[model samples]
Target: MQEISRVFDAERIQWASATASGHTVNSAEAYQATGVSDLLPRSPRQLVFVECDVLGLEPAEVCDHHNPGDPGYDRQPQEYLQGSSLGQVLSLLGKEPTHEQRIIAAADHCLTHAYRGECPGVDPAELADWRERSRAARFGLTHEEIQMRIRIATKALERAERIKVG
Candidate 1:
């Protein structure tokens, strides 16, 4: 556990296949294993903490967490998790502004891509293309594997100290 945590501490990107499991997906225990809780976003809300739910899964399954803050002021364990489906659960998230990356995404309003149907002016063909690209990129992921990778990526980005890939 200590060795793996060392790796997570050094790399904020995806976890290697050896260390992850369903139980540790969103728990503080996982964060502890990585030893990098201090670097997470300040938001009481964890949704915006996610830069991309682009991982091939339902929106509900993205890095979901449930952090019931402690009795007083100390918001221990955060209030979010990495894989959820309930709207009400989303509501309980921390009420803080998104971190910088999220702000950039919101400024672009990329979420609109998900519901482009509502935007009469946007081209339908464009939406189809986007979906295709996303599908192509996620070709290797099973429905469940997709959800799991997204959760780990989201949490690591939000809380891990540093992340890099080669």
Candidate 2:
């Protein structure tokens, strides 16, 4: 969400609850939450719906991989599955996925599988550290703690050496 906001220079970042299935949010609900009305004429103020179904919007406006029949889901490469949304958004923004972003995609899909060579050239220790951080961030963290974690991770990445193996 933060990445999307940064790319679009979005004025606001809002969170919307997923629908009954817990896999996706209703497009209408998401738009409402974001204060984007489909009825309004399209303008420079675009609403790029990430990981949500498109109810009354064009396919180009959405970046998701959860619904099989939806254009967003169909556009994703089969191997990436759940992890494709971020890459899709990055591609749409004319940016390549960074190594860390690739790691994030692989981790989101399946960390264990990713460690077993799916995400080649990435260090397992780094992956494990990310897993720990993810687990820690999943519950009971205040905003300050989250910010602290982000800062620590950023600093660690800056100091870390990249290692690639065949």
Best by the lDDT measure: 2
RMSD of 2: 11.0
Q: What is the per-residue lDDT of model 2 for residues 39-115, given as tens digits with 9 covering 90 to 100?
A: 44445455566765444544346666556753345432235433466666777666777777766666654557667
lDDT of 1: 0.33
CA error at residue 127 for candidate 1, angstroms: 1.1
Candidate 2, superposed: residue stretches over 4 Å from native: 1-47, 70-83, 138-166
Best by TM-score: 2
Error of 2 at 5 (Å): 4.2
lDDT of each: 0.33, 0.56
Candidate 1 segments exceeding 4 Å error: 1-48, 51-116, 140-166
